[model samples]
Structure formats: structure tokens, C-alpha cells
Target: MKKIFIISVLSLMLAVSVFSASKKKYGKEITVKETTKISEIIANPEKFEGKRVLVKGPIVDVCKERGCWIKIGSDKEFESIRFKVEDGVIVFPLDIKGMTAAAEGIVSVKKYSVEELIKSGEEHAKKEGTTFDASTVKEPKIVLQIKGEGARVDGK
Candidate 1:
């Protein structure tokens, strides 16, 4: 009777673990649509604030201080988008420099001046508390920004 009870408890625990794992997977798989135009995205960031969006564009530049933001082009002529990396997500590689990528993330449209961006980079570095140089940080022309939990690299 003792052995049988132990086995039953173990089986119940295993079943619950599997169920919880599946639930998490299903939740992650649920794709949310929150796309917007670069102009609209920047003009009225409040509309799409904190919402996951699908953005596609060429990788103009990657933040040197920390691979936090990726600059993408806008639909409008001579315009670009500046996407900030979501907190705790893996940073994309710089090798993908000129390649076009499709990324999904929450969008935040805010005005960030060059000095502000540099200061932000410095603050981010300081927060990490690592011995890193902030002088090399470069700011890009931002158009549309997307930040989320998961990002899969699409075809080159």
C-alpha cells in the first residue's frame, strides 16, 4: 500500500508538470498582431504602446554600447525605425548588419535625441556594472521601435 501511494503521487506530479509545460508553450505560440506604420508609430506611440508588433526592414545599424536597438527603414522616403530590444531577451548579432529581418515585439514610439540616446547607453552600461567604455556608442535615426519577449530571425 505504501509503494502504491508513492507511485500515485509521483505520477500525479508528473502529469501536472507536463500540463503546465504545455500551457506555457501554447501561451507563447499565440501570435498577437500590433503592426503600425513608421510615421504613425512615431507620431502616436501611445496607440501601440506596450503592444507586440511585427516589423520588417533592413538592419541599418546596431547599438554599439549594447545591442539594445536596431535601426530599420520606414515606408516613407529617407526615413528609418529605431527598435529597442526587450528586457532580458537575447541580443541579435551584428553580423546581420545589412540583411533584412522580420521581428516581433512591443512597440514604443518616443522622441530620443542623440544626447539622450548616448546618455541612455551610458546608464545601461552603468546598470550592468561592468567595466565597459561608453564613448564608442553610436545613435541611429529611429523610426519604428518594437520590443517583446521572443524574436526569431527570419530568412536573410
Candidate 2:
């Protein structure tokens, strides 16, 4: 009887583990075999720009409205990279923040002047239903982001 009870407990644990490890896929299937470090991409974005890369990280932020983008944590502390998908193509769940995700996409780099940054910031803030403080703008900024094509987010 004790052996049977032990086996039952182990079976139940295995079942739960399998169930919780479910994955939710979005967009096309990821074809990239190599994974790139987020830190490396951010540090030298020019080299990676327009190249397809696969990156894995924790989901740090997501678009609250259209779910068109997600910011994933970088290998470096306090750094993250945004993966943006076409609106209505791949919609990430707002609640997916904090979950682990693997995404594949091409890197994109853009330079913005202070004025342009302020305008874009204000527009983004308005879309997010938040207020923007344009006075914070002090310098030109270069943005590196991913044009996401596919992703797989852990269910749990």
C-alpha cells in the first residue's frame, strides 16, 4: 500500500509539471537555430541591424492596448529590448509580463533628435494613457528594437 501511494504521488506531480509547462505560440514558427545575447545586440546594434536573431528572456513589459510589442529583459542588469510585431498580426497577452519568452526577429536601429524624441514620447504616453514630461528631453537618442516575427511564451 505504501509503494502504491508513493507512485500515485509521483504521477500526480509529473502530470502537474507537464501541464504547467505549456507554451503559447504567436505568429510564424521560429526558424532561427542560434540564440543571441540581448546585451551583445544592444551594445553593438549596428552590426546586428537588419539581421534575424533569436533571443530568450523574461517579459518585462507589454503593450497594454493593442499588444503589439513586448520588452524583454537583457542579460545586462536594468537593460531591456523591445520586440515589436505588426498590430493585429501577433497579439501578446498583457498578463504575459514576468513569464519567459523566446522570440525571433530582425534588429532595427533608429536615431532620434531630442525634439523628435519628445514628440514620440508624448505620443506613446498618450497611447498608454499616461502623461509625458517633455522637459526631460536633453539629448538625441538611438533606439534599437526587434521587428518581431514569432515568439513562444511559457504559459505559467
Candidate 3:
């Protein structure tokens, strides 16, 4: 009886250890730098790819169909860094445009061909009943993820 009880206790301990190990392996938490620059991210996308990144910038535009994404850059002339909401995540309000925001999420790389971008622009223009110039259209690599709350709309 004594031997059987000892064996049962040992088996239970082994099972608990295995369960804990499995949980740790599948769970991953990410931390992002607070002041990451678009130039740096573009220069080395691989370094930040799939990792949570925090960035602060003005919201240039918002898409009702595609969802909320911000363009990050010093000026509109420079190609803006685009960050889109990730899958299975709720997007922020569209009124965020023109508001300075700080967001955090997993960095993703998206590639679009010129032809594809033109088609997309045309579709968007049609939906909005506005003319879109495909000639000036740019196919940019984008980041997809969640936007965390950081600041109010007033830039305070």
C-alpha cells in the first residue's frame, strides 16, 4: 500500500510539470519600443516583423471598408508608414483622423503590386464617387496590428 501511494504521487507531479511546460511554450508576450521611427522600421523590416511595436504619429486617413490605419511620416510628400488593424481585432473610430495617436501592435509586412494598387484605388474611388489618380498611386509595405490607447485626441 505504501509503495502504491508513493507511485501515484510521483505520477501526479510529472503530469503537472508537463502541463505547465506546454502552456509556456504556446504563450508568447511581446513588448515594443515606445519611440520607433518609420525610417528605422522600413530600413530593417525583418528586425521588427511580427513583433509588437509602438509608434506615435498623426492619422492621415481612415478607411471605412478596410478599417482604421494611420500614416506615419514627417510630411505627406514622404511616403507614409501605414499601420492597419490586424485580423480579429476591433478598429478604432474613424474620427481619429488628424488626431495624434500612439499605437502598439505586431508589425507586419504587406506587399502590393502597382497593378493591384491601381485596381484598389479605382474601386475605392468608385465607392466614394470621387476621381482617383492611379498615376500617383504608390504600393507601400504596411504593418498590421492593434492600436493601444496612449493619448487623447487633443494631443495633450
Candidate 4:
């Protein structure tokens, strides 16, 4: 019984350390204001459009192939904005899923034609190991994304 109790205590300690370290490993610290929901941004994109805002949430998806971009939102359904940094500037880890993070950047709206969307979708599908139906997006798509210059990952 003593050995089982000791093992459980050590396991708990290890888990706590890992959780804290995971947040530290992802992004650098940046001063940001209150958290904003992706749904809020999606509701009236023009309000936050071309403006800097603080977005905080769990990472729903990441660039598995490369630490290029991360999807931060409340859940999978609301994973609206894609946060990315410049090449070789900031690289989010592939294992950043479920980690709480804050990103500060200007909200951007990129309009792409059906062909462009299809190609981009295919690339995303290949990188994320998911299936994409490009044909479904027949018209041009106005994509809302956040190009973050700075980020703060809560070492929670």
C-alpha cells in the first residue's frame, strides 16, 4: 500500500511539471488585454477587422507537418481564426493542442477564388491529415485569420 501511494504521488508531481512545461514550450510572452471569442470576431468581422486584439483559448489544431500555424478557439466548431507568424519568426509546436494561449495580431480577411480555395484546402488537408472536399466551395471564400506578431502561452 505504501509503495502504491508513493507511486501515485510521484505520478501526480510529474503530471504537474509536464503541464506547466508544455505551455512554456509553445510561444513567447506578450502583453495582451482580455480574451476575445472567435465567435465574436466571426459575428461582426468588420469591427475587429484590420485591428489588433487579444484572443485566448485552447489549441484545437496545429500544423503537424510544421510548427507554422495554430487554431485557437473554444471548441472544434468555433475554431475560426488561424494564427500564424512569419517564416522562421515564431513556430508553434505540433503538440500544442488543448494548451491555453493568447495571441495578439491584426484580424485579416483574405478573399480567394474557388480554385484558390480548393488548392489551399488540399494543402491544409495534406498537412493536417484530414479530408477536404474542394468542390463544396464553389464561390469565392472570405477567410478570417489572425497574423500574430506576438503570443503568450499560459504556463497553466
Candidate 5:
């Protein structure tokens, strides 16, 4: 009876560990200890430029082609930040869109000319299977993004 009970306990523990290992880790391991809010980052991105930051949010969008990037939504409605990793370096799953993601990376600030913006917008639209209206882009735009180093995405 004692042997049987011990075996059962070990089996239960193993099963639990296996079942709970749902989070998918990608790229390098997360090293940042403090998490910056996505809204704060979006509101004052220049302050965090070239700095390493950790952030958490719902996976609002993912790169449709190679999963090279994910748009993590801020707590505030209509706000989100994109975490972009090198192509084929860390391909996030498209099915994880509704899940939560904790990502770490350096904040990048860049200015794109109107022509560059239009080109990128068109490319993005093609990737998203949507239409791009270049007329909406009237001037150069400065965008903030995270050049992702690593991420941990929770499964739904």
C-alpha cells in the first residue's frame, strides 16, 4: 500500500508539472526586472529610447507572415506597442493573439519620411491582408517600438 501511494503521488506531481508548462518562451531569456507600462511607453517614448524595458500586455496582434512581431495592448483602450524581433529569430504563434505576453527589449525611436511611411504602410497592409490609404500619411512620422530580445507568452 505504501509503494502504491508513493507512485501515485509522484505521478500526480509529474502530470501537474507537465500541464502547467504552457507558457512559450522565445529568443533570449528575459533579464529586465521592472515592467514598464505600455501606455507610459507610448505617451513618452523618447524618455525610454535606447533603454532596456520589460512590459506585459494582451497580445493584440501578431505578424501574419512570419510572426516576427506582436502588438501588445496597453491597459488603456486604443493604446498598444509593437514588440519586433528579428525575422526567424523568434516567431510568435498567431494563435496566441488573445493571450498575455511578457516581453523584454530595448526601446527604439525612429523617424520615417512620408515616402518611407507610405511604403511601410503598404507593406504592412499587404501582410495584414488589408488596404492602405497612403493619403492619410501627410508627413513624416516618429514611431516607438521595442526591438525584442526575449518574451514569454502565456497560453489561453
Candidate 6:
């Protein structure tokens, strides 16, 4: 009887996760003028650094831990940059993944220490129930993140 109960509980947990992942959360709409290609901005980070820009793209990854950050690219297959909200200022929902979003924020090249990267990797692994090897993050890296001021997710 105990074995049966354990299996039932595991199944229920799996179902719940699946249900949650399938749900999409749309955020408040803000008027933004997206006038630059993300690629152009990325190619010339120096020109746009510290400047606020509106970028539109499908979210490649959402921070599973707190939804405080997202990696959005111009195209699904070719995008590579992360945009994060100022701590405690905005909290995006994890369900926003795969949704097209337009975000306006100041672009900056944020640098991270090796230890800080390790901690972030560990936190993300815990949230996803996976294993992360901190050693894999070998050196300090520059991450281009947008310090968001306002944003919105398009209809799913």
C-alpha cells in the first residue's frame, strides 16, 4: 500500500509541473517604440551602453528561480543576450518563456565574478532540480543585460 501511495504522489507532482509549464502569463502592456534591431545593438554595444532601448523578441530562457531575468534574442535560433530587472523593482513570471516580449531598459555590459557565476549556476540548478558543476564556469564573463524600466508580453 505504501508503494502504491508513493507512485501516486510522484505522478501528481509530475502532473502539477506539466500544468504549470503549459500556462502562460502575460504582463502589463506599456507603450514602447522598438526602433532598433537587437543585432545592431549587440554588434555595437558601446554605442548603446547606458542608453534605454526597446527590443522585441521571443524569450529564449526565463530565470526559473525568480523570473528576474530573461535571455531574449531577435530570432529564436540566433539570439544571445540577457535582460534582467533591477532587484526588487520588477519580478517577471517564469511562464513568460516562448512568448514574444518588448522590453525597454538601459543596456549595459554587466560583469560577473567567477564565484558569483557559480552561485547563480547553483541557484538555477536547484530551481530546475538539476545538477550544476560550478567548475564549468571557468572565468569571469561580461553579460549584456537590460536594466528594465517598463515592458510587456504579447498575447499568446
Ranking by TM-score: 5, 2, 4, 6, 3, 1
Residues 55-133, model 3: lDDT tens digits: 6667777666654455555332464666665433535456667777555566677677788888888998899999999
lDDT-based ranking: 2, 5, 4, 6, 1, 3
- Candidate 5 lDDT over 3-92, as tens digits, reads 999999999999988766744888899998989998888889789999999999999999888999999999899988999999998989
Query: Could you list the CA RMSD of all candidates, in the order they appear?
Result: 8.1, 7.3, 11.6, 7.4, 5.2, 10.4
3 or 6, which is superior by lDDT? Answer: 6
The lDDT values for all models are: 0.63, 0.93, 0.60, 0.77, 0.92, 0.76
Best by lDDT: 2
* TM-score of decoy 5: 0.81
Q: How much does candidate 3 score in TM-score? A: 0.56
Give the range of the ten consecutive residues with the poorest summed lDDT in model 4.
22-31
lDDT of 3 at 59: 70
**Taking the candidates one at a time, how many backbone clashes does each contain?**
5, 0, 0, 0, 0, 0
lDDT of 1 by residue, 1-156 (tens): 999999999999999999765431211232646545666666667787877777666778877655666777776768677767653354656665676655666776566676776777778768778654556655643434675444444346
In model 3, the Cα lDDT at residue 89 comes to 50
Q: Give the C-alpha lDDT of model 5.
A: 0.92
**How does model 2 score by TM-score?**
0.80
- Per-residue lDDT tens digits for candidate 2, residues 22-106, read 4378898999999999999999999999999999999999998899999999989989999999999999989899998899999
* Worst window of 10 by summed lDDT in candidate 3: 22-31
Superposition TM-score, candidate 6 onto the true structure: 0.65
Collision pairs in model 1 = 80-143, 81-143, 81-144, 82-143, 106-147
| Two-way TM-score contest, 2 vs 6, winner | 2
User: Residue 145 of model 6: what lDDT?
Assistant: 72
lDDT of residue 138 for candidate 5: 100
